[model samples]
Target chain A: MSSWQIIQQSLPLFEKGFVLTLWLSFIGIIGSIIVGLICSLLKYFRVPILSKIAVIYVEVSRNTPLLVQLFFLYYAFPVLGFKLNAELCGIVGLIFLGGSYMAEGFSGGFDGVSKTQVETGKAIGLSQLQLARYVVFPQGLILSVPALAANMIFLIKETSIFTVIAIPEMTNTALDLIGMYYRSNEYLLMLVIGYALILIPLSLILTILEKRVRYGSFGN
Target chain B: MAHSGINVLFEGRNLIRLFGGLWTTVEIAGVALILGLLLGIVLGVLRTFPNRLLRLVLRLYLEFFRITPTVVLLFLFYYILPRQLGVNLPANQMAMLAFALWTSAEMSDIVRGALISVPKHQRESGMAIGLNRWQLYRYVLIPQAVSLELPATVNLVTRVIKTTSVLMLISVMDVINVGQQVVEANNQKFPTGVFWVYGMIFVMYFAIDYPLSWWAKRLDKKRLERANG
Candidate 1:
């Protein structure tokens, strides 16, 4: 089929798939950031046992394949009695996976906060909580924005794995459409374009954001 | 419920079959890493060029590969490429191609970062010694770059090994696929057999990835110590 013909046929389906893709990634990114921040804060505060467990969780999740993690969450959880639908499994698995990486990002950011800054905060009679909330947290967020943005982009791409468990995301939708039309060429090409559409703009925005943050007061 | 089927996964012959699958996984990752390093070096060098056009092209290539999910890329290559090109290749070859492409993008970034991290004065010193650009890079620049690049490169190798799991999607019969096959053969066991099978796969991945991670850490520490000294 001609490229235009393929575009005409696949555009509507691609739009729907794109929306689902956005939803999965958006939820995954927000969930991961919250989980990651909590874990990072726990580690930063030296929360003894919890910190140790958080370290293990971050290391294992970051090192392993996302596909394995997804499979473990999707297939093994039910065997262990926690039954989740494919969409829920995808989102939860992605959060767990993305959270680990984001934890590292936040930890790196936290580390970049100079020791003297925290010491100065303490000297000024600020409580530990006040120091973290006002001083360390703001600087850490700015310092870690680039890495966090990169990890979020990775999470967006990773939503494609939902197709394995049939979550009707972009790849799953594309597969079904291709199966119905028998036009693998058309749908797959459109799929690539669709992915680029999501990825390129996000990446460019991240780059610009990183540049701004770098040049902003964070550098000083 | 009582079990009726033979436990093939536990049998010696079936164990060998699974081992063969494990070997294939290693082979795919091993070859892809080597090819990826070569491509990564080339692209990395191109990325550092003074020419604007070369920089632009490399940037686009890097962004496309970086953002496009590996699963989507694998699907494109395995399913769509054959249809578009009207040619067929084995699943293993297709997996290698997709991985090599993906790994190259990642490795190039590592290479670029390492190269850029070298002090500019070192380049000036080489020029002051009357060395040409090629000679400067060959002797002074690349040696330091390689040292800095080693840890990141090792980390990339571990990534390739982990990423090979995606081959299960293409039906390459790797370790994960073997686990899936075992799960299918023993559905009556509910979750016990499947749990152990996946648990073993996780252990296998850890067994491979953890050591490389340690080695990368060791390299970083050594480099830091040498610099401090």
Candidate 2:
């Protein structure tokens, strides 16, 4: 079978898969950012034992492969109770994986905010919470935008691993089509092209977003 | 049950066997890393060539490699490539090829950044001294670029080490795969088996990557101090 024919036949399936991929990546990125921000704030506030636990979580999650983490979450989690659907398991796995990486990004961004900014906010008689809310957090967001975008791009590509647990994302769809048709050559080529179609635009969009964020003045 | 499983992992020769698996993982990572550094430097330089076509080709290569997941690439090389080429390769050799390609793309970006960061004045001075392009790169550019590149390169080593675990997916039986196998063989132990085995794998990775990360940080600190002082 010609690659073109295979793609023409598989286009709807690929579209559906692409939608799932985008959904997984978008949700995972947002979820992870929230998780990372919360953990980062906890560490930043020096919340006693919580900070130490956050440190351990970040270290272990960051050090290991996402595949193993996904496997543990998907396959092993059920054994210990707490059943989850494949998609949910994959998203949770991605959340843990992306969250750890983003913690570093958030922490770095938080650290980059000058001490004087906080002191200045204090001099204006803002409460501790108000100081961070009105002054520090915005600057940290701006500082972390580039790192956060890069992490999100990585998370999108890493979502391909969800195929392993049968999530019917782009890669999984390709694997299934291949299995059914046995058109290894055509299917593999379409798979690569399918990924490239999603990934290239995502990367370009991210680069543009990073540039805009860098150039835009956000009322500092 | 947990104690029995732990005994199996730690007993007479099992610890030694696990260490041997760890050694193989290191060997795979170390050899692939060295090869990748060399390939990356070359490709990085090629990408910056005065020739636009060369730059375009390199960009395409970089984009494809960068965007594709390493596991997919591994599957391609291991499963598809041999069938297409009508030649079979051992799984280990295919893993090496896939990783080398992936690392080359990553390292090339680092190399390009490091080289470009060199001051323009140095290049001008080299040209003024009648040094050819090759001589300029050798004497003037590379030495400085190496210093800038060292920290990123060390971080790349950590990436390569962590990525080596993917080889297990293709059945190469690296450290993680062995851990999985040991856990499976002691299935009745449930989560405890996985916990200890994966914990050991985690420690092994930490032992290697932690020092590399430390050295990279130390290098950055020293470089900053030098700039200030």
Candidate 3:
């Protein structure tokens, strides 16, 4: 088949896979954010044993390869009597991995907050929870938006690995089409474009946010 | 699970084989890092040049590598590139090419950031001291940029080491691949060896990466303190 005909025929499949990639990234990002917040807060508050556990978790996640983590979940989990479908395993693996990276981002954000601000919040009779929610979160969120944006893009790129376990994300869909059509070069180019479509806009937004952060729009 | 699997891993020459795999892993990472550093310096220097067309092309190259998944890149190199080009390269060569591509993009950013962080006044001062453009970069600019980029480059090396795990998927016969093969052969005799096998792989990675990461973080913290001034 001509390259034009191949692209026309493959566009719909690529769209389906592209949407699947976005959805998986959405779930992974949401799940990771919650996990990251909990872990970072644990460390921030120095919550006894949980803080140490959180540290170890972050270290382990950051140090190991995502592929090993995914493989561990996919192959080793069932051996340990926890059987999740490949998609769930991929998402969960991503959450744990992304969460660790995000926790570092969040902890950096928390560290960026001035101690005087915390003291001022306390002086104003704000409870610790109230202080954290109202005073600290806004500052930290502004500081962390760039990190979070970068991590989200990383997570989206990682979603391609789901293809290995048969998740039918963009990469896998393209792999399948390539096999079916025997147009390896064309389809691979298409795959790169498919990813760029999602990532380029995200990166542009990150640059803008980073600029805003540096300009002190949210206040230093 | 099975005690035999644990014993099997420790027994015979299996441990030696795993270590050999580690050697292979390190070799690949070292090669990629060196190649990437060279390529990154070229690309990074080109990025900072006054030529708009050159900058535009470099930006596209950086973005293409940066945004694509490493796994996808591996597939393209391993599966597609050779077939399309009508030339057959070995799997290890392809793996190295893919990794070098990824690392070059990362390293270029590091170089660019480090170069940008150097004050323009330093360049002016170098010129005032009768330094030519080359001397300005060599004597004044690159020295500072290299120091600033050291910690980040170390972190990048650790990352590349971790990423080598993915090479197993392409049958690169790295540590993970060798370990998997051993586990498969012993799986029938020792069905519960999955955790031990994979866990060991994780530990091996951690052993290599954790200390390096810690040192990088320390260096980065120190660099940040200096930069903050």
lDDT of 3 by residue, A1-220 (tens): 7998889889999999999999999999999999999999999889999999999999999999888898889887788799999889889988989999899889878766666787889999999899889888878777887778878898998898787678889999988987787888878888999999999998998898788876652435
**Candidate 2 residue runs with Cα over 4 Å from true position:** A1-4, A113-137, A216-220, B1-5, B11-17, B188-192, B221-229
What's the true lDDT of residue B78 in model 3?
78
**Candidate 3 at B123: error in angstroms?**
2.2
lDDT of 1 at A137: 87
Candidate 1 chain A lDDT trough over 10 residues, lowest sum: A211-220
Measured by DockQ, the strongest candidate is: 3
Give a tens-digit lDDT track for model 2, residues A5-80.
8778988998899889889999999999999988899888889999999988887777777876776776555655
Q: What's the true lDDT of residue A164 in model 1?
A: 82
Q: State residue B200's C-alpha deviation in candidate 2, in Å.
A: 3.0
Kindly list the per-residue Cα lDDT of model 1 for residues A34-75, writing each as its tens digit: 989989988999898999999888878877888888788888
Q: Chain A TM-score, candidate 3?
A: 0.89
Q: How close is every model to the real structure, measured as TM-score? A: 0.91, 0.87, 0.92
Tell me which residue pairs clash in candidate 2: none
Residue-level lDDT tens digits of model 3 in B1-229: 4465467577567778888888888888888888988898878877877899988988888888889888888888876777868658888877887888889888888898889889989978888989987887788988999989999898888888988887886888899888888778777777777777788888899999999999998998787677554
Candidate 3 CAPRI classification by DockQ: medium
> What are the DockQ scores of the candidates, in order?
0.61, 0.42, 0.71
* Residue-level lDDT tens digits of model 1 in B1-229: 6543235357445566667778899999887888988999989877877899988888888887886788878888887668768768899988888898888999889888888889999988999999996798789888999999998899789878987888888899998898788777767654456666676678778788988877986897688667644
- Per-residue error for A199 in candidate 1, Å, reads 1.3
The lowest-lDDT stretch of 10 consecutive residues in candidate 3 chain B is B1-10
